[model samples]
Target chain A: MAIQREHELHSRRRGRNVAMGLILGGLVAMIFAVSIVKLSQSQSEDSTAPNYVPATAGASE
Target chain B: MADVSSIDTREYEAQFGDYVELLKPRVMRLVVFTALVGMLVAPVPVHPVIAFASILCIAIGAGASGALNMWWDRDIDAIMKRTMGRPIPSGRVQPGEALAIGLALSGLSVMLLAVFANLAAAGWLAFTIFFYVVVYSIGLKRRTPQNIVIGGAAGAFPPLLGWVVATGSISVEPVLLVALILIWTPPHFWALALWRNEDYKAAGIPMLPVARGERVTRRYIFGYTLLLIPVALAPSFTQIGGIAYFAVSLVLNVVLLAGAWRLLKRQESDRDADNFRAEKQFFGFTIVYLFVHFVMLLVEATLRAFDLSITALPIWF
Candidate 1:
């Protein structure tokens, strides 16, 4: 009975750690996803910007 | 029957779980996030698909480093309470197997980045893996109290690597991002070390708290936390951030400094339940503090691109 109780306590402690890890991991993943989406949106916006100066002109000048 | 039992014991070691507890997944997420931010914030424009490839390579490289770190630290890990249940220590994974996996992943990640991204990004990725596995884990971790201070540079590389991926070169912005993370690392880690000093002592690892007295360690932690505020506020002066980031940085730094001061001033005997709880809160807040700072930067960059005036903070040239 004592051995079983100790085992249960060990598993309980492990469960807590795992839960904390999972929560933190989920938050990190969400942040990464948000950053990626924002990056994509920014890139699209940049592509639509007007290019008054010709790409080759600056190099030649 | 006894002979058969002995033979069964030899054959029945726990199997490895590649999908779980490799520490790869956790480290990979940090790498991906920081690198993505770097790519997005860079002055040079990168193609969307190329950017994706760059983040992916950085993630793989980070994972490879984690695997190598696991392999190398397996021995020490088995003795430490915190790491006692890691795959290798728990007999779920063999050291040789981990070594092979780490090497294979390291080569593949670097080569893929070199081909798909730029040589500079790939070079940084390779160096990151080398620094984590060789310089930090093997050279500094066991030998010095300044382990995290120097090893922190290994973790700081992802942002710089990401910048190179986008711009095909390095610059002041990425260096500043690297510096912010490097400065933040010691306080973040030392707080945990303070609480878990006993485990480190038992494991014979030369963490700051284990090597130096806890009083000295607390002073170091306070000093780092104080230094981190200025560095954290640095982005606000740069073109990357604005008044919103500056406000957040100011308020957050005050809170962080307060926590560090409290931790620093507490007596040895007073490191009981309440004190420990306070330290834990500080540690948890530190994580959110960093995430919020980075997220604000990302938001500011997006606003700048749109020519939207969120705040009138001066942008450093």
Candidate 2:
């Protein structure tokens, strides 16, 4: 009976750990997802093409 | 979490090394570098002695923030392996002592800046410390994952403060510099968080990687890096930087984006190999990238004073 009780306690502890891990993991994941979406949307609106200007007066305008 | 009552009184020791560690010297170095850049790049010239004094006060203010952060986060620091050896956690310095030192230094730094430099610079420095300690460390760090993103503004203030010290007023140029640092902070810190997620997890801190999976963190990292390229290039569109700055920024941004993309592409199993390398390279290159960009700005400003037009880049994006 004692041995069975010990095994049950161990399983309960394991279950708690997994639950905590998943909760924390999910929270972190959500943060990253939101930040990425926000950033990417902002990027899409801003053009990536470079507009180079001449460095000197002699260079073609 | 261990109760404060459970801590052994006999274990606490206020040692010299403990006080030094409380300062977060590593972070202070970056603050000093960025502040120096701001001072150097300003349009108005400051005397060498005053510049040195201003930077010193800024460094002290940064250290004060570090000490306060360490004092407040002692509970979580004890749990996180990465921060386990911190002065408070290791019992080398009592928490109260750390708090005292931080608060004292914060006041000293601001007072000295105001007396020796200008009130404007001192006011900004005080605000930065308050923002870091109260706003970011206490209010934001644990409660939200957007902590670093928002908290990044505190770190971004040094350069602007430095510029104000030289010019005695705020301007568009300093604002652009602050914006660049503000945007850069998210990806830089998040990259570190990705590799150290486990530490954050064990400590119960909700860092992006700890709450989010690695894949999502990688994508976020890439997106931020992509955004940073244009932000870094913004100075080129101002009176501050010329052709030299633009050329360096363009090349550096391309390299940084490629590195970020490579990091995003790696699988979990291969993270330690490819992704780690990419992160390290991008991190290292970022230091040089900012340094070169600022140096070019200083050079361009110097050339302009001599009536030599190296380049007259547009003043807006």
Candidate 3:
């Protein structure tokens, strides 16, 4: 009996899968980075803008 | 019954590069460069990470549009010698797959841009994609001779989108960049249309040269190039331009003018064995013309940032 061998179709599929994996992985990394940046920027801007929260809270005292 | 097991899968082999080619990577480079310059030259500085994300979204949006264009124009693309080997037309990538990639990337880019950049920029990116895919590719291209003139706006929007990404609002400086590309597109595209007029005729694209006579086309190229000089020079007077920009603009415009002039003089009778020497030269110069202008603006902005004086420097030396 002859030994079985992987066909060319498998390699092409593997190539597509690997490429898709990289693209999806990169997108995840990008979204994570962008979210972190947005949060940090929001925090920085809020710190400089003044705190009305404490002023409103003092009325309850 | 067809032999399903015997069917060849070799023809279906599409590498990652095929998908990149589908996105029109060549055109994407122009978008990326112009957008980068737009961000770099904006009055307000963008954070590096934010800038990176912003440009990426814009580029992806541009790529998505290109893929959609390939999907829509697949029929004509197959006929045109220039585009026949393109992924969709050549069968390396399927039409449905191209459409899916285009739509998916378009949504991803617009959403990411809104989250990362401002809503205004995101909205503009979405509009740019729609304009390119719908307005240019579908609406204008087949129906009118003025397709490129109107469709050119789709290409010209990148710098403005980049500007919006940085400043979060529109302003004259970046609007100037937008105008620069708008005026530049006609001659840039028309010059190629003059040389590759055959391709346009074959593809039924109704390019300026195909719809109008070559003489009229040449005249238009000269006319637009004439208009381009002042528009290109206008930046030198504005904040976008300085002494360096002024001098460089003068030289580049003169060079482009000379080429456009030579092309205008050349007739169909002047084509020596299918060689559009003057037309080809003008087309090449137009690329350099847009590139150098944007580069100069970036240089001007960098100089201003560091407070270096171009006039004070030994420029000629």
Candidate 4:
């Protein structure tokens, strides 16, 4: 029997690889975004309370 | 061109779509919708980004559980007419691949929820997955005719988890939504089981219609639909509901009861002639029934958020 010219297996592998790349990239971006949001949220909470100055800031050595 | 069977078919590989099929995207849509509604209707306002992220995590968790279910149920899936074309049973994907995908996604979703949301929500997500895959799928499914009754809780958890994600604690409102799904499940599933009775029987599964007899199954479905009325209406008593919710629930419950009553009268002769038309219709409508309830909750949330709600104050806690 004559084989089909199309590399169906290789084509599927290539598509899967491309999809994996896209998903991984998206996940990395999402994690970065989440981290930024977490940091900003904590910072805003800190800003809401009274500001504190260290005792050593004005003390002479 | 190649003779189809002459190609080196042993090296056949699954495409990306097969992997996606393992996630059960259709079911994930329901999870996403319910969870989103559950989060939005909460008294606490969540950050938009956090809300989006939380919904995505919940969806991933649902997908993971679905993959796990497919992996475990591949045997029975192959035997069932309904599920014979699934990725694993169709030989498009391997069981180990499904197991790995399920585990990996499950861990990723839980970790993300813990970091971005709260530990309580993450723990709930983990527990939900465990309940579905281990408790329901492995332990109860083949063993008992009451499997659907208990396993239904697995599907009911997403909304409650969403509420927890937003509020960082469990509350009466989300629990009511969970109960609503729980009440809706057996009837919806049994309706399908009634029509697909032979499939379950051939698979040696103990679905209600197969084990309890069709008449009994119909009665149970009717009973559950009757029971759905109060559980579906419970949200109206809480701060979660508005005027639209009450009206929608009242109307939908009546329609559902009417549908159930019609289904209850279904006989074997009717089934053989029309292939359980009433059961099929009842099953389809039950899906719509649950969906419309949640959609009305969203509508009520919108009204309450704008201070346009008629029933602005709850009559009781």
Among all candidates shown, the one with the greatest lDDT: 4
Highest-scoring model, TM-score: 4
Ranking by DockQ: 3, 4, 1, 2
lDDT string, candidate 1, B1-317, tens digits: 13322333333343334424565687678888988888888777776756776687788788878988999998888888888877888877778878887897789879878866668889999999999999999999999999999899999998899888877888778888899889888988988988888888987889999999889988998999988988889888777878878888899999999999998888877778466887788789888888888888888888889988366777673
True contacts kept of 4: 0.52
lDDT tens digits, residues B1-317, model 2? 44444444463334455577799999888888888888877777766656776788899899999999999999999998888899989877889989999999999889877855678899999999999999999999998887898789998998898888887788888898888888887778887887778899888888888877788888988998888887888888777777778887899888888878888988877776565666666667766766777777777777777868565576673
Off by over 4 Å in 2: A1-61, B1-13, B272-275, B302-309
Residue pairs in collision within model 1: none
lDDT of 3 by residue, B246-298 (tens): 89999999999988888877777787655877778778888888999999988
Clash pairs detected, candidate 4: none
Q: Could you tell me which 10 consecutive residues in candidate 1 chain B have the lowest summed lDDT?
A: B1-10
Pitting candidate 1 against candidate 4, the one with the higher TM-score is 4
TM-score-based ranking, best first? 4, 3, 1, 2
Evaluation by TM-score, superior candidate among 2 and 4: 4
